[model samples]
Target: MSSTRKKSSRGREGSKNRRWSDRVTKQSNALDLESKIFKSTNPRRIALSLKRSAQASKRRKGTPYQSAMSMLNFYINRAGKSLSQKQKRVLERAKDELRDVFGRK
Candidate 1:
């Protein structure tokens, strides 16, 4: 009985590991452009950098303009709860400039 219980537990652990591995694989498939976005203090520079990074990444989905905007929105949504009002405003302006740079506007 104890051996059977151990076997069942091991099977459960294997399934859990597989799930974790799948999650990691999906996350790894996405382009991580957060560092470039956060490296600059100037909003226009940040926007330009993000646009360039998105254009360069083959792994990103959608057009370069869409990918750039998605990355910016993802960053803003991720930081929205913790960011200061001034910081949020800066990011918003960056999104506007990003649109202009990409001719999305």
Candidate 2:
């Protein structure tokens, strides 16, 4: 229909002439107002993001030894298939270091 075609053409014209800065300024003002209102809230009532106790527990956990053990296990499991002698020796040395680092042997 001609009416439908005219309506779509009008929409295209309106969009073509609209200033980009007007939309950007409106969005910028909205975010600025939101941040100002958020900052006005009581600081003491803000929920803690990361718990101190959880972080302390994580810090006390062994990380390097666990990763080294996992690496050693992977290399050991893959040792028997298609590797050269030099590669096998290097992997064996790394496994020994992993065991010593973890105080296992």
Candidate 3:
């Protein structure tokens, strides 16, 4: 029988600067987020879309509310200093809207 060789790590990842967190946000086992959902200016729309996605996703690890909120927080936190003040405000408002949609007070 022929022996099998182990795979190499070199060039296995697409980019040198790529981080595991980046890959998780883009291609995780969680919800399949809408394209550019974070770019929306309307908070309610963002919340509603998140709710819909979370409710429909069987892959989410937490409750729909929890998963959606976590995903939103993850994007905001990951964006960090690069996120614009205006955009950040919109996203924060979306969190509030999300809570309201879920009736979580």
Q: Report the Cα lDDT for residue 59, model 2.
A: 33
Top of the candidates by TM-score: 3
Note each model's CA RMSD in angstroms: 7.3, 22.6, 8.3
Residues 1-105 of candidate 3: C-alpha lDDT, one tens digit per residue: 879987666665656655666666677578887877888999999999999999999988889999999988988898434789999999999999999999998
Best candidate (score: lDDT): 3
Q: What is the Cα-based lDDT of residue 20 in candidate 1? A: 48
Off by over 4 Å in 2: 1-63
- TM-score computed on alpha carbons, candidate 2: 0.31
Q: Alpha carbon lDDT of residue 58, candidate 2?
A: 36
Native-to-model Cα distance after best TM-score fit, residue 101 in candidate 3, in Å: 0.5
Across residues 1-105, which tens digit of lDDT does each residue of candidate 1 receive?
A: 355433455666677665543343235354545453553567898788878777788987788888778767766775344677787888889999999899877
TM-score of each: 0.65, 0.31, 0.78
Clash count per candidate: 0, 0, 0
For model 2, how does the per-residue alpha-carbon lDDT over 1-105 read when each residue is reduced to its tens digit? 455533455666778656544343233321221222112223211111111121233332445445334423443354234556665565565555445544567
Error of 1 at 29 (Å): 4.0
Candidate 1 ranges beyond 4 A from true positions: 1-28, 32-36
